[model samples]
Target: MAARRRRDNVLVAVLAVLAVLGGGRTILGWFSTPPPGPSDDTTTKIVGRSQLAESFARDFVVTYLSASANQQDKIAEYVSSGQQVTLPSTGRQVSDPAVVFAEREVSNPQLEVWSVTISAKVGKGAGTAVGTSSSAAASTASSSGTTTSASNASATAGPGRQYYRVAVSVAAGRVRALSLPAAVDAPGRGSDLALANQNSCSPDTPFGQVVSGFLTAYLTGSGDLSRYTVPNSGMVAPAPAPFVSVETATVSTDTTGCGTGGGTARVLATVNPKATDGASPTLAYPLTMIFSAGQWQVQRIDPLPPLRNPLTVVVGDATQGPQVQSTPSSVATTSPSSAVQVPPAKQN
Candidate 1:
């Protein structure tokens, strides 16, 4: 009996030791692992629209303006150089990537939430133009396939519409392509122009209203965005152009690879000014939107016509009757395009 009681006490001591060790491990894991709940902040970095816009502008200038071979070779960094870009003189022909970058102008910066309707047709057209590239060609056939090469290349590219949303991200003050959200398919609009006039064209007929709702939800963290989708199915529609907007325009969507990774939507109608009395002008082009987190968000607004900077020109003749000599004008010929390096907005 004595021996048995001694053995029982030893067993109890071993079990208690095991429990303490196990509990220590569990506590360590609790401390090391991330909590199983929503994070305080999901954005990698929170920044204001002005800072984001200015950063985008600076990157646009540097990528397009830098002179070294580094700048020249860097063309592939933003866009595939082999792809087609409009020449200044020719309409839409494949040209040097540098030339297209050269035309990039980052002025009259405006960032806001507004509704935009993307035409499926225009999306298809841009995709078609981009679909026929050598890189896409290389997808199929060993580097040496001959007769079936081009067609095979197109096939290897996968369907152009599969990638509905073009993901854009700004890192270290430079804009680069990023991963897109999951849902990217827009129910086919089927080449209809008149449909644009009706709210059924999308959740909001005015389109800007839809965009406003999106911005309200995304920027201000208010409002629900379930209806902004293409089919109103509660799923977000993919948009091709996430970063750039064209003027009031018609777009074709039948071609492949227009907005490649992001689905493409074309501009089929013109937008009149939304703010009639504001100092800022109205939208001249259609908008492109991306579906994210169960709602469509405006990623690109249409490019407006260039606004002329206010000038103060004085008409004076140096050769007038009064004895006068020509003096250099006080107005500087080259002023800074924009103030360099506005600090990023301070975070709380």
Candidate 2:
């Protein structure tokens, strides 16, 4: 009996030791492993590469499209000599061609090659005669898949808009080469144009009042946005500080083709940037609104489109204020209107 009890005690001791060791391992594992969380490095390299590609595309397009005396040299700075093609000498100059959108895809990671699609506006310069000449040149380039001289490259590019794809190689944050521009077929208004809708709400209605109040709150950052906008509507909490003020606003309502329950509206506002220094510039803000919860709220704020007037403004700069997001399903269906038509470029 004494031997058996001693053996039992030894067995109990071994079992307890095993349990303690297992528990210790679990504790160590708990300390060793980290809980999952958002990672900043996720797609960081890809995004950086995309930005570089876009920058290269912008520089290449602007330099190639501009009919300047130093156009070839400017383009050569961004691409290889072999890639640099001589543009037509038609003196068809495009002043201030701004990039509207850019899409980049990595084609070869080892070679740092990217395929980029760019949409840009060619501001009016010299007149329709230069426009005609440039359009002709663009048509020629499109057909041959190679940059040709002014004589063979005579075709209309468009009213003042162009979309093209180019292959780019970037290394060490610099553009090494760019392929010849391949035109992307952009026939219709594309996704930039908003579908037309019938007007249902008037400026004197309560919906209009709510819209005005919402705009005031959004621009001034004075009121709670949560009270006016739906949750997850892409509006940042504690609305960003306003860099501009509304000088005048004309509200128009659109009821047709806005989905089932609600409709859309627009407020054409004349705004002035509030600069700390002297002389701030004035701009136009086409605010898209929607009827929600029996009241009007901001759906989207279209970027300042290209304007033909002397007081026209371009809001594409980094210093520009926050852009209003697209409308949520609870609000409407139609996207924002096409950017305002840009006026002719100021001559030198």
Candidate 3:
């Protein structure tokens, strides 16, 4: 009887230990957190799509506007079958078709579309019709008299500024469709004044003196500009003139659009260039002045009514290949005698 009771007690103790372990596991399972599942970030995906769209739009515009027969052939590769490529028959030449902005109009896993708007200078020139300019005689002989007159009319049309819109579509990492280019209105000019920041400089201080001195040097192309401009300022000295005449000089404490101040000021100066032959046209200078090395210096000279898009590509006739022209830093106004204040330099 004693041996049997000891065996029973050992069995009961083993059962209790197993029950305790099982219960502990069950409790832990109820409170423990599961590992996180995979997540997809949509922001990164959207940004990537935008970049792709912009690149496609830029390339399409450049290629479509190309006068080269080789470039025209490349356009078909970017679009699907049966898509119409309606190019100007008169061979409209465009310069500086820069994309000011672009955005995605439609997005999907299988297909994406983008709308790109650009600013360009559009012009028409002689001998831009299909085929070589030397073929003018051949065209005249093959076509009717009216056709020749039409060609002449096209040749006489001058160039004008215009904005354009292009639509691009992508699928499976390839351009699948493209829309015909269309003309659109340009965006309105934005405010020229920059927001007030720590870099602001007063117009009457050394900054002003620096601006005046720099303008004097710039107009006459002869002055001690070292005391008034930073080294490597890229300020081009005007060619020597018989005399420099300043009709107006307006100084502003507002750096608004010029740039961040190390020491900078904006000066709107109306200058009259008097040459030995006669009185030259009056020009305006929207000057940005910077202070450096214990003196205020000229930093940058902005074109009046700043260019909307600086990266403009000039497309020449068939004989001439496409050429890229940098936006002019200084612009001459059409009005010879206008008291227009220089707009402030914008923040980059």
Measured by lDDT, the strongest candidate is 3
Write candidate 3's Cα lDDT for 1-348 as tens digits.
999999999999999999999999999989989766534676776667767766777666656665454345676766654665555544456554456567778877888888887554445542243322223222333332322333553454444335568887867666644766677765554333221121223334444445555666666655555545567776667565445553334343344423233455555555556655667656666666555554455667766522223223333321111333433333322221212122233244
Tell me the TM-score of model 2.
0.39
Instruction: Tell me the TM-score of each prediction against the true structure.
Output: 0.19, 0.39, 0.39
Off by over 4 Å in 3: 1-75, 84-100, 104-113, 118-162, 169-178, 189-210, 218-221, 229-348
The residue ranges of model 2 lying beyond 4 angstroms of the native Cα positions read 1-39, 67-75, 83-86, 89-91, 107-109, 119-159, 190-348
Write down the lDDT that model 1 would get: 0.33
Given candidate 3, what's the lDDT at residue 73?
A: 61
lDDT of 2 at 274: 59
lDDT of 1 by residue, 84-167 (tens): 433222122121111011122232233132111111111223333333444333322222242234564466433331212223
**Better model by TM-score: candidate 1 vs candidate 2:** 2
